[model samples]
Target chain A: MSKKDKSFEVLMGELETLVSTLEGEDLNLDDAIKHNEEALQLIKLCRERLDSARQKIDKLVQSADGEWQKQPLD
Target chain B: MAQLPELNNTLSVSQITGHIQHTLEQDYGNVWVKGEISNLTRHSSGHWYFSLKDSGAQLGSVMFSRQNQSVRVEITHGMEVTAHGRISVYAPQGRYQLIVDQMLPAGQGDLHLAFEALKKKLDGQGLFDPTRKQALPPYPDRVGIVTSPTGAAIRDMINILSRRFPLAELLLIPVKVQGEGAAAEIAHAIEIFNQRQDCQVLIIGRGGGSLEDLWAFNEEVVARAIAGSSIPIVSAVGHETDTTISDFVADRRAPTPSAAAELAVPDKIELDNRLSNLGQRLQKNILNRVERHEQRLNAIQGSYALKRPVLMINQASQRLDNMQDHSLRMVKEKIGNYGSKLDGFEQQVKALNPLSVLVRGFAVLSKPDGKIIRSVNQLKVGDQVQVRLSDGEVQSTIDSLNSKKK
Candidate 1:
């Protein structure tokens, strides 16, 4: 999934995986640099998401015709 | 009807009492009664003896420890209650009483009874089994809330959820929390959320209220919906002390609606700290790897193998110089020895010199043909000869022949 579409849970999971892989004893410098860059990017994305999040509230209402619709709650 | 009673056969009081006990116990094997509690006594043995009475009549009641252990509400004198039990006769006292198994406050006793009954039934069906409970997602993308739209419970939940984790969207299904169709609406909302599959977790709860006001949460329908939900649910009902059937059936239980919101999602501050830590660790690891590689590079550059060619050339030239010096020394020593040998040979040549003997007055003779006449027999008479002395030579002819003795 695109970075924007990935859930916070998935993003955090990927970040953790990268960090641990980089921490291993035998990884070459090239691979370590690559993983480090990717992990830092993920951290940036996660922080931005956490900082910019605004709780979106939606109220679900069923119409008289028996169809359910959702609208933003005030 | 056909046989006449033997009135003359007098019956003892115990016999009459036994008959009365059998009839009364058999007729009221199980019954429910509503009355004001009077003369309540909690005995040391943990049994409760009380009287259930109206103005006209009173019924003796005894609730054993085992049955009353599960009763959550407190019972006091003059409090109205609804009690369920079988009738039993005390033969020795000639009295019958209600052996109460359950009791609740009179006003909402029916709802409480229903709650207990549904709790027991669903528990027996293993709907509340820990194995059946699903794990809540660590990071919920959306939280489905089933509650009244305008209640304080929803407000509190929204406040807490927004403060802790705003990443999750709150999907609210506004429903009547109590009145007639509240249970059906709550159940339907839960089912709808499950069908949509949008919410990762659900919080079903309400603000604290009287038992009647919170009856919807205690309904069998709501409990069954929670049990059958594909999404894990956190049930928050009433206050910290109040518990509903929904709480027992849910995957998790929170004492209040705000607590349920907290349980539904993770806090962002903790995640932020963790992300920072991971970033630091990544940087450290990369730096360490680079430093190690650089150190290895430096060691390789300064290694002996890289400088070996020049060192080998220098060593070969030094060996060549040493060999040259050794050969020159050998040549000089040989020349000196040969020079002394040459001087000795010069002295020997002087000793054997005939020319030097001539200097001492030795004469030499030769025939006219330049052949030296070493014997007198070599010359014949009338042969010309030459005589050589140290300084002069003379030519002469032989006139007489002389024979020499052998």
Candidate 2:
């Protein structure tokens, strides 16, 4: 599955689930390795999402016509 | 004499005055009195005497300068005020008055009473129920803020939120935090945020202020708006000691705006540490699995079933070597027997040798014409013969033969 679309929380959750599954018994080596690779990918994606984050701040203002809209704030 | 006994129950004026003092002081201690101030007198002894009255009744009041100094509002004649203190009795005059320790403008005092009344009404409606409080999102992608644009509350919240988690977008709705219609403004901002539905959480607060300054958050409008919000709101109204009605109805309460910001987001450093730990565990687990499999393979390879062919070959070679040793030993024994027999044959051949016999004087005769004289009857009178002895052979004439009786 493509992990780029997943949110940080979702990716972290999937990584946790996969790691726990790999920890369980009765899994074959092939499936274990596959899950390991996927979990690693999820970790990378989560780290990137966290590291690349830059906060965006905005102010809600009313126009002369009385329409409310967001204006970017520093 | 009977009337004189009843007259003994009459009390002294001082004792009666003391009783009245205790009764009035005990009953009216720690009371709040609201009235229009009249007959104000600032004594040279740092005490002010006044009377609090509405249209129907008036009560004598006195506030020492020490207590009045802390009163923020200016108190004047005919200005409505609320005074808090105990009743004190002047024993000599037999008069009781309120001893004021704190005073405030009538409007601000009314706000406190109103706060209590609204708190009770909303509590009865279960607006402050824990079950009604929504759980704040663990990770919010967007946060809405309702506060004064120019205040430290907004700045502190922004700084803290950015430091903790920079992933969430902040949408601020700047509103007047106090004064006329401030509560309506705050309520409107909350409604707007709810309508937008983009923010996962909202922070509504202003920095520490006087009760009147923080009164907007205690208003019913703001409290109801916070309670009715679909998005979870964190109320951060004032200092740690100050609690507002909005704090009660909110999904979560923070003592200050900065604390509310912290409550709304997860720390990125903690997440990073968790991710690193999980990665290590995963790698360690996989490595352990591979090592176990390798051990299993080695065990299988070393098992007797896999080595059976080489074992069988070794056993066969061992048996063949034993048999070879047995046959070689028998052949050696037979050769030993033949060697003994050959020695016996050599002795027997030596005994049959003619030279060995002739050494004892034995002789053999042969006829020169292939005839030999053996007996007198078969032999003619003369015959040529050859004689062989151990040392020589000779030809001679046969002269006679003697025939003897058998």
TM-score of chain B of 2: 0.58
Residue-level lDDT of model 1, residues B165-271, one tens digit each, is 99989999999999999999999999999999999999998999978888999888898899889999999999998989899899999999999998999988887
Q: Which residue pairs of candidate 1 clash? A: none
Score chain B of each candidate by TM-score. 0.58, 0.58
- What is the DockQ for all candidates, taken in turn? 0.63, 0.52
Best by DockQ: 1
Instruction: Kindly list the per-residue Cα lDDT of model 1 for residues A14-68, writing each as its tens digit.
Output: 9988888888887888888888889999999999999999999999999999888
Per-residue C-alpha lDDT of model 2 across residues B105-133, encoded as one tens digit per residue:
98877876787789989999999999998
Cα lDDT listed for each candidate: 0.90, 0.89
What range of 10 consecutive residues in model 1 chain B has the weakest lDDT sum?
Answer: B107-116
